[model samples]
Target: MTTEEIRAEARGQAEAHLRALVGSDSAVLRDDQWSAIEALAVDSRRALVVQRTGWGKSAVYFVATLLLRSRGAGPTVIVSPLLALMRNQIAAAERAGIRAVTINSTNIEQWQPINDAINAGEVDVLLVSPERLNNPGFRDEVMPRLAATCGLLVVDEAHCISDWGHDFRPDYRRIRTLLADLPPGIPVLATTATANARVTADVAEQLVSATGEQEVLVLRGSLDRESLRLGVVRLRTAEMRLAWLADHLAEQPGSGIVYCLTVAATQEVAAFLRDRGHEVAAYSGQTDPTERAALESALVEGRVKALVATSALGMGFDASLGFVINLGAPQSPVAYYQQVGRAGRGTDDATVVLLPQLEDRDIWAYFASLAFPPEQLVRQTLEVLAQAPGSMSTVALETYVELSRNRLETLLKVLDVDGAVRRVKGGWVATGEPWSYDADRYARVAQARQREQDAMLDYLDTDRCRMRFLRDQLDDPDATDCGRCDNCGGLTLSSSVTEAAVDEAGAALSRPGVAIEPRKMWPTALANLGLDLKGKIGDGPVEGRAIARLTDLGHGQALRALFRADAVDGPVPPPLASALLTVMKDWAGDWTDRPVAIVGVESASRPQLVGDLATGLSRVMQIPVVGRFAIVDASVAPGQGAANSAQRVAAIHRRFRLEADVPAGPVLLVDDLVVSGWTLTVAGVALREAGATAVLPLTLGTQT
Candidate 1:
């Protein structure tokens, strides 16, 4: 597209005020962002921003939408990552006091409200999920009503279109088709945080091939959160590991989170910590919906002081909780970022203490054992979308080749992620009829896709920077060490090789109580390097065995390693052996600067409390340090709160709870993960009543 062509998409009046509105509100756009936006606005060349956390991506959409709207531009249809995100954005717009509406799977009737708004010429933005973009609801009732109203189409978390993204959702792959179907020349925009080379290239491909446009504006902010300090500890044994956690917790202020890889581990840790006097709250898949809500409430209401949970804690969770204490090594860097991101929403410094525990494989392997069969998925999808018994709906199967729905609800969801199928009476019917069908090809493709998924399991076994490896598969070929990632942070461990970190405690312990670290661990080791903690030797350790690495370490070992490897003070703890590794293998094809903020805090003068845990030893250290850790009151240690007080538990669960249920002045929703986004929608509605002006959703990773 030429400059003139790009200008034509937005009316002349829109092009004038766009720049000013680009970074306003909670959008937080930076310099690089402007460069990307400018390049996109003026040049025909493709420009993209490969940003990380804290980088404003949604601002780009809002700016563009507002710009186009100024010129009497039609509505901008944004392909939301989740229903929750759409609701959040609506809440934000309402909070901003801007009239915006969205429709999703849960509320098909929303189409009426949205259509009414479009007809009244009252809506500025139309947020829809990709699945909904091609749905009968949008095509028949919504799209035709707003066809002339929609000027621009935006795909949030565009990386999900490709299998390479951290959280790939099949439905995103079909977004390009929907764009292609839209009346010619409608400019399409997309944004994402977790994009690598493969994903980036995919995005470019999507813009060119699917949308039939060469000028796609790609704007990204930085990836670094410098205010958040980095520290890595090699596991010795379970006993030593637990002791090390005790010591690390002793040094931090506010309640912290300890993420486990398994529900059993979460339960065990919570029990152990509770017995040890820490107000430990546990959350896992096993916890019912009510219990989960209670747990979330506990964190927000300031009921519990500390929490032990599995990956369940990171999904759309919003809390200014003080610290993120990791008891288990995350399966991926994306997972790690999200679990830790819950802590630093406030301006106050917060701490994310990562204690890598070799995870138990029984859980993930069990997941594999329970994975739904491809054939079943396909058949169920067809069944749900079957037309009403009396009448048939002509829906093209090829158009939905890439749709995604909740696995648990695969049988119930007659439509795709977009909610297109219309249920009249007993049977169901969808809009798009099968364009062409090669049953053989469908079967082959289905199986091949299943095999491709096997690659994720393989990813778990690879020795590369988990983040880099994932991005390369999705975005770029030249992508290398993102300098800020764990791999770039100087951490490296090959899955093919088995080498134990230094075990000599005497050498690591320089002072009587202080542990002399072998070498300061690079960021990569903190984020990558899968170590087996359940006590297995050789290749067996690579498989999910709990090789008892840190927990087994005796008395002399635990505190010493804690003082050496985990402590981030004075200077470097261990000599980074991976400097050569990083220089030689540089996984990140290119280095993208990340957003960073740092501030100083005076040490607190308070007493530290250490305790004996149930069947374990737990100690609570007074709030001594407060950096990268947010706590309302640092003085109260973990054990100070009631063992079962809802207020106390709520405080501890705060990491997963929203600050307020009501919306304030155009409140923006900030989250690390975007799944179905329904959770965020619930949050958005809650925020609205609480006085939030409007609400928008910001997610680091969206399964678009």
Candidate 2:
């Protein structure tokens, strides 16, 4: 047979397989989708498919898997990003008679059996998280075998592999290494619904192998989603936003999503909507895995009105969702487009709304601050690993460095990519690869992020069609105004909120007293840092209270203003002071012992605020203001780089001296903010040793 005749036969088989998978006899593959399958199955070439969501990207893989497996090739390996995505893929694969198995954080016990099944050819496809690729045991033990035998490799959500992508993940960078290690001539496919030209180019260039510069079949498609009717609802305040959602959420055509910018907002909005008689639930990274699965299922089955969520719900969750409403804007237009694509996937028309707020920029800035740590800290971490001979767990390394757990994890992934460190079962070990900080690359990535933010702002304020602005931001070559958007046709979405609803929302947010759990143990690394502390803290402070998190919905705005970088540090304002009284009342139930004196932790930045808070607490509770703890040497005080427990404890210890005599009763410790909680732990230990019966730590706000 001629080459074209063979290709035609393969295409026929693939379409038959696809039709069977979707359970519809009329189902047919689009031409571009068929091209992707042909490239992967017959041509055996690397491919990158940049198509909009619900465009049969999954079909390309499932059909290719069927063709490849029929040729007696090994099972396909899919690097998926989210558990929700994995769950959806597994179900879809089963429908196609393809046996799909996953090894993720939620199912560790099944790893051994799954590994055995893969080895025995019982599983047709294996789905693993990007983080799993770099895990110590998986990387060392199973990855080599899988890389050698896997018939095809699929990277779902390939945009994450690019540093310039809207949601760049460090772990995803390890895919380049995996690609380089794959056996020769194995077809590789990467797919994403959200990559622009820049991101698409970045990701495509990274699809390399031992063969060197493999030709990637770049399949680009138009990104316009015709079913979505996009609009924006601008609100003057957070309360009004919540009220509008409560009043109008049920009016959406079907069960949908309501996106929030933070976990605190998720909780607050979910509660408020529930109070207004909507069946809703809060979904974020904080939700348990079982609960998240149930929530996803509920949304799919139309059992709930919406899942009030953060970006945790973003990635590859598959449903015929009918609408999406953003309570606050995402920082990037590309990200906004990806999220709104979730709606109108299965219907002719679905609503997509963005309620923009000035506060959203602050939230965006807080997240942006979590970008790659400075070069000094990176070098310091590398030096620590180099000096140590055996593998050191991240916990052990925390003794010598100051980065937080999440930040440290991110940094370690980068170092792993640079060959500066190796993660093992015991922990991480120095690779002795002589790595240098890529300052220019990091700077370029930062600049790219700023541009994305500016584009998002432009999207909010544009006089043109919202859909067109989004498409242009994504470098969609066929971008044009969609007559469906509010800007194009002037739909009647009101900014006005009912007074009764606004008042109820205000009351809900005003409810005070977010719990402040006490630190039960000192950082285990403290002993390694020459501190005499180890194990559980014997005299740790009792469970305390914070008026609110700086990220909370109601009191958060005021606290954030007070803590702004340029805001003048002064005494606690009248509004925050009044809120504290309510917090005190709410916390009264938890206090077993009432008689106490107040003690303030001296602050170099906010001396007046800390001092005034202590004094006010003393007056309101009728307890005496004992005294303040003064820094013996403010010059040596810990810097912001000391974000971990051990570093924070080491930096702040012995710097503060107790100025007042210890009272015989319980002591209330006051501070402006609580982050690592180490400062409070050390101060409480000192107060206890100084003969105080109990120490209760209180703060105006707690960093989440």
Candidate 3:
């Protein structure tokens, strides 16, 4: 049948399915969902699902599967990133009287059901995790048989496979290759609630085949979540922040999800909120799937009015939520979107509030550190694929190694097309995957290629227009500004922030080539380093370079001269001069080493908090007032260029009238934020024994 005719028959079947659902009183779905079915008909084969986290993205495909059930197109294979998500989808499908089964690492034996269904042409759908989907059995044995007989290949959390996606999973990298293994001419329907334009393109490129124009189609929806109101707040202490959250719920009431960065924090916040007389529930990775299921049921049915959670909930079930609050700062826009979108499940109005502490930067940096392993991963895979025997296809490579921790996943894919290797029958056997090589010469070539990608990542880390940086790397260099990013909102960035006017521009090698001190870099740098920019030089590696040599030709007039001569990833700042300033100021002994607590961020009726703190230090200790200070995220980020973070923090220290409370060693403390009186208390206790004049703390956020 033609694609459209097939789509029509499928829709008719789906309507019957939904009608059966309504008769059984299974769900309270709206008419818009039916409209979605028609829309699917018009755009039959390829699909794009744009909905909130709880909008039943899975339902759309499940309905499609049932619609096409009569055709006897064998069983549909659903690929989900997480094991839990696959199970959830399977469970929900089972509830609707649909025949569904799942298999992951935990139950590899259950995969026989999938093979049985494909052979009998009876199973409607088989849900499996991406990891399990590529297992030796499914890949070499099960998949080839189900190829043309398969009905549909539903890819869940499709964004995760996109390298630019926030929750990029290493396993998801094999998605494109897996798609190639699907049933011939079977419709490919992909769904993700978190993909941006950049990620969308990545998805298409990876899935694009040697077919006509419709190889992979794109569908987009407005991200302007009208029911959600967005707000940002910066704070210092957990006690005050929890209390504030409690008050917020008291006023906003109903049901909400409070997302915290850690399991312990989620537990603590849940307890703290409960003690304050708020109905609260907490979910973490530690919670078993059954307990998680119960909790999800509670929130959906409104038994629990609030839930404090870590990022553990699977992405399959549906819910109508009221509010989504960020209890701690999120690491990236993608993560923020997923959490915030958990609210506003299409049936209700939802609000999103963000509570950020400067320390959260350190927390995010900690997560970024995980990507470090991908470096060794790429080189090793290339080497392995280069030598072996047959075709070096991703599936072949996957069979040899349990997992690919490879760094350049995209490049490995590119090599597959460039005739670097051929696709052999059983799996990939390498044909040298050869390159110009005199062993050492090839090594140099490999290093150069690595540098090229490194330069791109550096651009992501150290360039302005993070969105543009990513777009450029993806080959859509001319794409317009993505309106949702922090950059589009006009936040000045350290990446592109030039010295207002550089009179003495090209003067390099002036300052000592010291490693940048990375403590608390100004928000400008941290925000700048956020994922959109690619190339990033950690403060640690930014030690005095062997010497700035022109890659093309050596000498130039301004710093731009160095930039223009030969393209390099980074080197935008001087070392942290503030540490020296701090040392110099401390040696004078007028400043307190201990910090005073700051209750208010802006001014208050009572001038109790440290206000003239910077002026006081400058006048008393005679320190330079460089006026280059900016807000700094106090959280320590070991994943960052330590030197970069430290230098920026030092620069921040010099400029602003920060709320500082230092200890009383020989000097008074100067702190910018005081969430509670604890920092002050600690500083005061330290200062009193040391015999310093005082301890003070400073901050700039929610006053009352």
Taking all chains together, each candidate's TM-score versus the true structure is 0.50, 0.98, 0.54
Candidate 1 has a TM-score of 0.50
- The reply for model 2, stretches above 4 Å from the true place, is 638-642
lDDT of 3 by residue, 1-704 (tens): 99878655655667667655434534543444544544443444555554445555666777767765655555677887655566557677776677887767667576676566657755678877766544556655666665556677777888777545667665666556666765445667777776766678777677664364455655554444445545554444443455567556755536778888777567656766676577888898787767877888788878888778877763554566877777665655556666766777654456566666534554554455444223344445557766664444453353323232242333443344433543344444344656331346435534533444444334324425534444443334244554433344533212121231121121211221111111221223222223121123212111011111111011101222323325333322222222224433333343333222212122221122233544444554554332211224434321122122222223222222333332323333333232222233333333444443432332211101
lDDT score for residue 533 of model 1 = 17
Rate residue 688 of model 3 by lDDT.
40
- Residues 1-704 of candidate 1 have per-residue lDDT tens digits of 77666555543333333334432433333556445544433332344556654455555556556655655768777777654356446655564435677777666766677677787778888877666645544555665545445766777767667644555666675565565556655556667666655567767776773434565555544444443433445565554455455444544556556787666557656765565566777888678756776777677556787678876665345455766777655544554655666665542656655555443332333343333335554554465455324533222221122222234233223234334444333334554554222357546534544444455444445555544554454334444544433434643221121122122222222111111111111111111112111221111100001111222222222323433324543311122111212321231122132112111111122111001110011011121111111234555543231221222322233322234333123333432223333334434444444554544332222222
lDDT of 1 at 452: 42
In model 3, how many backbone clashes occur? 73
Better of 1 and 2 by lDDT: 2
- How many times do residue backbones clash in model 1? 127
The lDDT, on a scale of 0 to 1, for candidate 2 is 0.88
lDDT of 3: 0.50
Per residue, candidate 2 scores C-alpha lDDT tens digits across 265-355 of 8998898999999999999999999999999999999999999999999889999988999988898999999999889888988999999
Deviation in Å, model 2, residue 113 alpha carbon: 1.4
Candidate with top TM-score is: 2
Worst 10 residues of 2 by lDDT: 634-643
Worst lDDT run of 10 residues, candidate 3, spans: 540-549
